[model samples]
Target: MANSIFIPLHAVPSGLNEIIDLIAFGFSDVGRSVPNVYSAKSSDADENWKDNFVFVEDVGSGERCWVSFFETTPDVTGNKEWTWLAGVTARWSWDFAGVVAYALCSYADSIVYNDSGVLTGQEEYSAKDLKGILSRD
Candidate 1:
């Protein structure tokens, strides 16, 4: 089973390219020092789904974690939004990958959406809660 969480960006800034760059920079700033942290972007048309997303993976020990982003439906006001997903493999702790996801969302001034699609305010996240969000078991 994997543990996962979804973060949604409320009002993305005007420039799309800038936001992508910001997310990449933010992830690097927080995750660069973590061992075996790697990042990639989807190249397949179907996989990308016309959204800007970066995927992060930890290629270290027995347990690994991953993070990525995807575009979601527009808000009521019709502003574009994105959902960032972070997850850890079974028995793995929320590590640098999770931190990078959080940092990317923070830099984008994003919000969180529960499984029910309700908006969650910008509140601090606990490891347990985040794991719960990512859990598939």
Candidate 2:
């Protein structure tokens, strides 16, 4: 199973592409759909044109902690919003996922979200909040 986080972006410095540099982490494009997601239309919703899917990894030593950049088709979903569905597999990868989200929050003007692990609402984590979680030893 994988733990997931939702990064609802407001305005990235150079659109979605900026995220590649902002995170400063190692990742590779395992695969991606054709036709480019940015040019997708709302009327094309029925086709469900989901976008890029990348795999995150450690900078060196090739430590693999699979992270998927699940970008859903916004127009099809009926909301003009974008989110980084950073899904982390395995327990060890959870922290890596947090680090990725933390870096994103620091550079971007938005918050990230995930399960609170409680019975109630989701946890809307800030860069500071994720730092606290990641710093725990």
lDDT of 1 by residue, 58-91 (tens): 4444434454444456552134544333222223
Model 1 scores a C-alpha lDDT of 0.43
What TM-score does structure 2 among the candidates reach?
Answer: 0.51
Work out how many backbone clashes candidate 2 has. Answer: 0
How well is each residue in 23-114 modelled by candidate 2, as lDDT tens digits?
Answer: 55312111111111122223422322234343445554343343344455555223365543444333445655556666656665556666
Candidate 2 lDDT at 107 equals: 62
TM-scores, one per candidate: 0.43, 0.51
Best by lDDT: 2
Q: Backbone clashes in each candidate structure, one number apiece?
A: 3, 0
Kindly report which residue pairs in candidate 2 clash with one another: none
Which stretches of model 1 miss by more than 4 angstroms? 10-55, 59-63, 74-91, 112-137
The best candidate by TM-score is 2
